[model samples]
Target: MADTAFHSARQRYADLGVDVDAALSRLAGISISLHCWQGDDVTGFESSSQSLGGGIAVTGSYPGKARNPAELREDLDKALSLIPGSHRLNLHASYGEFGGVKVDRDQIDVSHFAGWIDWARSRRMGLDFNPTFFSHPLAADGFTIAHSDDGIRGFWVRHGQICRKIGAAMGAALGSPTVTNVWIPDGYKDTPVDRLAPRRRLEDSLDRIFAEPLSPAHNLDAVEPKLFGLGSESYVVGSHEFYLGYAIRRGKLMCLDAGHYHPTETIADKLTSVLMSVDRVLLHVSRGVRWDSDHVVTLNEELLAISHELVRNDLLGRVHIGMDYFDASINRVAAWVIGARNVLKSLLIALLEPTERLRQVELNRDLTARLAILEECKSLPWGAVWDEYCRRQSTPVGQSWLDEVRAYEQLVLSKR
Candidate 1:
């Protein structure tokens, strides 16, 4: 059918049964956050305000394949040009392999790490502390604190404290803009395994997060959860979905990852329905089958369905989307672009929908129809799509990793 013919057809359907404009307008209000290289330092992002985030290294901790602090900060500086008004930064930190003992975080890069903190401090940006613990290492391959000996538990706690201390200080200096996002690749294997010790260890460590010395600076702790890696072994990974009512009872926040669910889970609608019940939400989203592998991928039909559900449900507040990816084989920036564009487009799909009846049952049909609506609204610029999509986000956390490039040292001995 011709454009006119198509419009007429849509009108004919509406003339009999649907209220397209009302539905489309209702969905127009939905929005989401997109990650990028930190463009500049601009913390103070309010979840209610719908903020954005930027980062350099999300998967790797060390400097070898990762961007040093200075380089990351610089990349963020440039990212700021494109991502102004954004203020959330996911700090690149190191972690141990799955099930394996978390590495000597002390041995990891320090100067750049601290530099990123200092940058956040100076620029007044919020830092989503994400220490990298790739699953590729011996420690990550199905090993976890649960299976470790008492001695290993001691070692892990000590390391956790050090990272927490730094994290608290950064949060305090930045005030209300701290986001300590912790996602451990911890779980069990198919075989029978010890569980008590790891459960105790993780529980004990988590309690410390809310303990005394409140770090008034870093009071926000977004415990993010994912399934594919360790959920196979451990039943209690992050427990955001499992422990929402419990965490609320404890006065802590709950972080939910959109991509962490199996395909059967209607995450978006559930999130919208549940957003009000939690203390806070730290969003970890990506394009995937929901039942299969979940690194960042281009947001496709399956992904959009949930995203649109996220829109209709109104869960953009108290939520920040993360690009949870780990592909050592690809250029990091390529990964970044893929994540960014997908998020932006997902939002457009949501907006283009007839805002009225946003239930998924109708969204698929409406989205296909709305593209024509957008194109036909002749005076509107294509850029309107971008504006409609970049959901409200937290403040921007951009920094200059440039100045700290040459800095390096052993954090272990420094403690001495």
Candidate 2:
């Protein structure tokens, strides 16, 4: 019955000039980087008593959270098994294996992440990296790179410099370029008296941090911007404009996080504009609830629009797709599967679009036909094509993946 349904759907799509098979083929080639912090709720193995500061917070005490790297890897393995296609793993600087030793952010080395490199290489997966600038004593006052004190700012600078080298090492070892992103939660609760000084300091800090350039094949540098956070409600130093100019001038990749912008603003609209200035982009796909709540990715209007923008504009190669969310309210592994599958599903729907036909209608200035075709395209058999994709990938078809997660929770996560 499944095969029959898929065949019928394929024919139906073909009638509309949509190639279902081609869409599945393209979707399989694209990889969405899965964030490691989500598995452990941003609580790295570095310290148990470390407080989440610098405008970062993870709510909910969901049981079965991965307490160690081993457990996190175990849970990731299960999540990856359920998710189709090859994907990359995104790791933070704090998640390195320090062997219970006191390794400060500045003191971290590639040696700490050797285990991760080996694990990713063994699985034939690529890796991405981020410098954790939050949740530390140095960052307690809600500043790091842009701190007024040079000593404190320099400390964070060293961390970023070291993280880039570690990212390069991972990429060199895995034969894939690692996008090492820098996102500092440097801001003030109230309106800053002098935002210019901090911005200048940040620019200098970043210049020093990225001075030792590595090959793009080994490490691609990216800077992520946030509008505001918990304590940084009034002013976020690294606003969108700050990084957009920096990226354009420095030739670095700009990371557009979905939840980083205002509720009314969507990253989809900014892709074409940002790409015009920056050479490449790194997307941190997430669903925002009024603010940067970091909710799980859903197949909503924004997600579909983002996916469509990438597909229609032919910017997939120039953009590094990744997911950024931490929903601890539910099963952690299930959250991973849900977000990843939705991301893939969105991409599949985008790829299955009759872009040429739509463009042709728009080129003829037929607004009526363009709107009509877009609405009709939404009702097509995209879900059937997605099920066929899962079947081909040897993954669970539809909600059956949830059953695997429930069973794993009983056998593994429950014990944890």
For this target, which candidate reaches the highest lDDT against the unseen true structure? 2
TM-score of 2: 0.99
> Scored by CA lDDT, what does every candidate get?
0.47, 0.93
lDDT (10s digit) by residue, model 2, range 1-416: 99999999999989888888888889999999999989988989898776577787888888999988899999999999999999999999999999989999999999999999999999999999999999999999999999999899989999999999999999999999999999999999998899898899999999999999699989999999999988999999999999999999999999999999999999999999999988899999999997665998888999999999999999999999999999888899999999999999999999988999999999999999999999998998889999999999999999999999999999999997
**Local accuracy of candidate 1 as per-residue lDDT tens digits, 363-411:** 6777755555534532223233333223232212222222222222122
Runs in model 1 deviating more than 4 A are: 1-67, 78-87, 95-103, 106-112, 121-124, 131-148, 193-201, 213-217, 230-246, 289-294, 351-384, 387-416
> What would you estimate as the lDDT of candidate 2?
0.93
